[model samples]
Target: MDRATGTTDPGGGTRMTDRLLGVRRCLAAAPADLLLERLGTELARTYGTTETELLQVDYRLAALVPLSGAEPVIGAGTPAWRCFDHQSEVVQGGALHVPVTMRGDRLGVLRLAPVPDDPERRGELAEVATTLAHELVAVRPGTDRYAVGARTRRLTLAAEMQWELLPGRSRIRPSFSLAGQLEPAYAVRGDSFDWADDGQRVWLSTVNGMGEGVTASMLTCLGTNALRNARRAGLELADQASLADQAIYSYHQGIQHLSALLLELDLQTGVVTAVDAGSPRLLVLRGSEVIEQPLDDQFPLGMFDGTLYQSQRFELSVGDRLFVVSDGVPEAASQTARYGETALHRSVRRTRSMAPLEAVRSLLGDLRAFVGSDLVDDAVVVCLDWTGRV
Candidate 1:
């Protein structure tokens, strides 16, 4: 309600209410590019400006992306420090200058040049800039909303590509069930889960590549494709591991490593076969007892050619559960503590009595509570249960 910065409207509540409603509409819309376009149009119209530009901060690249209606006067990939150093927004003659900021973060500066005769509209334009900044912060990206409009289009496209490669929410068969979830859903990278069934056997793999963003995503994509091809060819667990390792080595030249687990389940005998390579530990639950699978220090996938991997076999009883996960689950840490094996053991025990899908949901909930937030790394959980009735 600070009128000095135009936080409150001159006519009191009506204009402010309309602006809030507009923000709500923006939030409800699909396609971030469209939303940003709409926001830019509204800002230009409301401020009576010939042009309005939005700039966003890219933390990964340490640069700003410019959202401009005009071409090339100022563009994306501008240095953040230079903008701050210049205290950007002062125009030489007829141009208006305004900085778009939210909380203490400077999203980007807005440049609007008015016609020569309209000197009186500067305050109105400044007010609009302030309101827009607040609206950006309140809706998406929270404290960094100013950057949202600038990065929305490209990020949205990338998110769509990521979604296209992901598995369904749940994969159900006559004998078992599997499900997974990724944290910070819109920006997830470096976590992938895949499953293939050849009628005689079911093969499942979960992989977490090092680091994040496009590079990690590409590595995961390559490994996932290799896994599918190897399994479809009916390669034995060791052969499949070798093939996948060769593919990774050839593709990345030893630059990346994938913490992976490849599981094969026989539909006829209810036997679970697995190969664990530097992954987070897998948990097996029977009755009231929870046991960790013996990983035994195998090298991660893609590390070296001819690295031998051995498969471990377990008999699956009715109502028994298998929990496969990426490090994102067990390694999730709050400011003070890590969600270690002990916490995971207790969570799995508490949910041992639930249906496979419900148990997976409960386990993830418990993990989130332990971490105190969504995990920083990509987290994935694949739960398999043997429904004795099948």
Candidate 2:
């Protein structure tokens, strides 16, 4: 085997390939956290060593996350940037050095001990490292490598920025309360929710921009700003949606597509007027039963000019609830099943009698259980409760 050209013994190639494929299958079948653990086990098995170390590069902390095994020097304590500076493998008796790289980008270095350093062995290790790196990028939190369709540093930066724009926790109000939680919250890009009180009414809106990463984040920012301006101008729910649609259309030259829901809650009357554009189904829960709100079913905003959207009005009573969610909620799939509308409805019914925040937490907990782990796409859950007139 040659380390330079990735040449390997016939038997070694077959074994490595099998191991890589098996690892992928295992990861694909497991939850995010379990997948990491499975990866560590696979690495140990593939390397034919029990003492294996997996490190995740964290630039912010300037440290490496030890995915598995033990390395007193590099595990949990060593700074990640320091490893990049000291490129050469660090060995201090009973230790080994193996650099993990993907498409020329150095992710981190793996350290193991008591294994001989041979070209054939190193080459095989490199192949495994490459495969693992690709898997990490694919399944990593907050990233949709396939959806983005390209690998660039900008995508990571955009994801980070989008995360910063979200609400920190579920929100509470006197007449009405609203709260939202996003799955993979740290890596979300296009999904955003906003709420504002205009003394008489509370305006709530959630938007999911088309695509992912930088483009989606940019569109979301534009839509958010448009909604804010429209609300500030005392525009109605439908008018705010129209304004947002126009802003998106003009910004993208009529090329952007976005799903949005705008709701206006009149504190004095307990009336909720809403405009929905290509968003997911909204649910209104009363006691043990859940009712689905009818949507306009119009095309997503920004796809056409002069697209008129109508607002559906519903009267809210004390203890009645509203659930607004992104497609991610119903679309979340596990290895065996998807958490569809039925599951969502059941979850909502079970929590219909709970407080607004508790209901939101219950729905989120149910979603995580149904999906069996963190979701692949961004899941946004906005729960609103009407507590009688102000």
Q: How many collisions per candidate? A: 0, 2
- Which residue pairs show backbone clashes in model 1? none
**How much is 279 displaced in model 2, in angstroms?**
1.3
What is the Cα-based lDDT of residue 174 in candidate 2? Answer: 67
User: Candidate 2 has what TM-score?
Assistant: 0.59
Tens digits of per-residue lDDT, candidate 1, 130-167, equal: 55655555554333333443443344333444544665
Q: What tens-digit string does per-residue lDDT give for candidate 2 at 54-73? A: 56543221245565433323
Worst 10 residues of 1 by lDDT: 69-78
Local distance difference test, each candidate: 0.64, 0.67
Residue-pair clashes, model 2: 2
Cα lDDT of candidate 2 equals 0.67
